[model samples]
Target: MRKKYVIIKVFKMDERGVKLYQPDAQIKKGWLSLWRQMFSELIGSRELIWRLFVRDFLAKYKQAVFGVAWALIMPLVMVGVFVFLNRAGVINIGTTDIPYPAFALLGLSIWQVFATGLTACSNSIVAGGSMVVKINFAKESLVIASLAQALFDFLVRIGLLVVVFVILRVVPAWTTLLVPFALIPLLLFTLGLGLILSLLTALMRDIPHIVTLLTTFLLFLTPVLYPVPQGKLFAILNRYNPLSTLIIEIRNLVIVGRITEPLRFMIISLFCLFLFLVCWRIFHLVEPRMAERV
Candidate 1:
């Protein structure tokens, strides 16, 4: 009878390659070491991450006649339709602290960052194609690089938001100075969800498409195009939805003078930090197997 063998691939435990197998395999590295390697590899791979970012960035805009302008187009159209409906009484989006156009555009800008980043990260590994299969480098770089494109889109939308503010002649609140700081939680939450979605997406090619559709559906529920409607329904709903809290508070900083839900925002931000660390660990653990799957 021929003996059978099962080969398992894993990250090396040390400078000398060491593999783990089932019950008897002892992990020589501590949890601190796991954390250290994750950061160290990411830091060491900075150049590769940059190269990937630039390659994808140029490849995306260079092929487009609209170039970077594509970023502002979708949100601009959404703002127009919503504003029209509000005026025509076809719908009531409620009142905003700023002009509705500025309000909706700003909200959409923030929301799209999450939407686009999620899609980009989810598709990243599969899009890397033969490179993922052949390369022995940090796969997280691909997710990060893809996410950069969404951020580029975000910067473009920021310019549009500024234009809307100017046209509306709305000077933002004094707290607007804190806009950059206020945005940290939003960015972290998006990255945390993006990391987890990327891993799921690698296992199933259809996952990215589903994420895009789901985010679009979520936009309606999220108060992105409107102020939260009156009554406990939306208030309670927004309270539970972390994305709603992030958008509303960031917009509040820009226009409303204070965070309406500071406690909730703080809680959500802390949760996002925890989620990011956990998701990152999961991604790192499974990264060695990603090449074969992708």
Candidate 2:
């Protein structure tokens, strides 16, 4: 038999010394692009997201006189205002199963996770415009990274919650471990809404100002400072409002030892997941144009 030799060729850079990566057709816009974008974003941008998270986290407290103290300030201010209002007969929070201070603070802590995360993620692209245009990287990292600040703030408030429990001589339920499941839907809801707002905010500068006003209005509309109302108006609003359901359930889990409405929370969880997918799809399709818009 005659001896035969085969030679294999390895892909090398062109004469100009530039390496070419294979184009990913799946990344283009389509119905499935949403899942592709999510996979790319979550899997591919893991390290980038962490780096951005760290950068934003450090920069947030770097030059501030109060440093991380600012994280606790807003919730404390709300607590004080509500306490004063309740005392002066200006407003009635009604009866809570737990102490008013702990009840309100617990609700506010979870609410801030949604509120602050939404606000930061909404401005992520606009705030990081210089880098958005200059860096060729996953844009969703900006939004995902913004959640780190909210999570950190939430952890700080949790410490305050423990103090309130101790001072008030109230014991939280064993069901507190289930709080994370409740929080996941809230995070998804915030991210879904944030992605839509961030895209719009990048294209239109006025969106952030509008978001600020909306956040203030939403706090009152939500049942954070008060017990869930039984009036016709509040009943209808709570029926339609997803945040109310999540917050109320989380508050119940922590204070009352069980979820008040398991079915409602399950529905909201599904809705939030669907909403996130739709928002991500729109964001993925529009992302190519974002650098120019910003």
Candidate 3:
């Protein structure tokens, strides 16, 4: 087998108005030049990302009658089932700091940002399809643009959250302002996993479907619809699951004005940042080959 190489040119200009040309190092060859290359492309392609984001955002709602309402509807339907079950005493979801409906809805809204972003970003390369083969650009743009749709849906669902709060007559804690800051780690973790998964989904077409299925299963395990269980088997799972801590910390901030485990939250946030950096580098290194796979 032969190795494939990409030649990168680094151009520097000195005071004499002469150009100096040097060869950039490959990351696979364990060099730092690729980092500069990737950052340059990512920063330079902001307009391209916005264009792609707008195209996808419009395409999603163009033919749909309900449009953004589906965002609120789906979460409401899911939470409604749990609300009914708890009311019927078929299962105890445990007491929430706010009403159960409010608590579950808030958790699911935050969770959907990760779940939807993961599924969307994983499919992004394949969804780019013809354009990816025909054009040359940073493939990261596709995954990043795909994430914008989920964020739009998340903003739309904020209306439902406000409605729930008004109806239940529950006032959120002042620390609710910190919810967005807490969510930064969750978003980073999702984008990191999604960046790697996007490449995989191109190689194996079924990966996106599997990702969707896994996210659905994880909903039951991650305490989106219930309070953290006490000393149960799941408490251990919650203790380590980054998503659980992210969602729970945000929720507690909304209701209690405090984070239950500030140290744990800080640790998970750092892990998320590390994971995102590693995954981003992996994506940048392999992106040239993605066109062939897709």
Per-prediction TM-score, please? 0.90, 0.89, 0.90
Instruction: Choose the strongest candidate by lDDT.
Output: 3
Q: Give each model's whole-structure lDDT.
A: 0.81, 0.84, 0.86
Candidate 1 positional error at 42, Å: 1.4
- Backbone clashes counted, model 3: 0
Over 4 Å off, model 2: 1-30
Q: Please give, for residues 14-116, the per-residue lDDT of candidate 1 as tens digits.
A: 5576645442123554567668878998899899989999999899889899998988888889889999999999998776778889888988988888888
Over 1-294, each residue of candidate 3 has an lDDT whose tens digit, in order, gives: 855544433334346857544444232543465567678889999999999999998888889999878888899999999899999999998778899999999999999999999999999998998988899788899999988888888889888999999999989999989888888898899899999999999899889779978999999899888888887788788877889999888889988899989999999999999999899988976666666668
- lDDT of model 3 at residue 210? 94
Off by over 4 Å in 3: 1-30
Global Cα RMSD, each model: 3.8, 8.3, 3.8
lDDT of model 2, residue 73:
91
* Clashing pairs for predicted structure model 1, backbone only: none
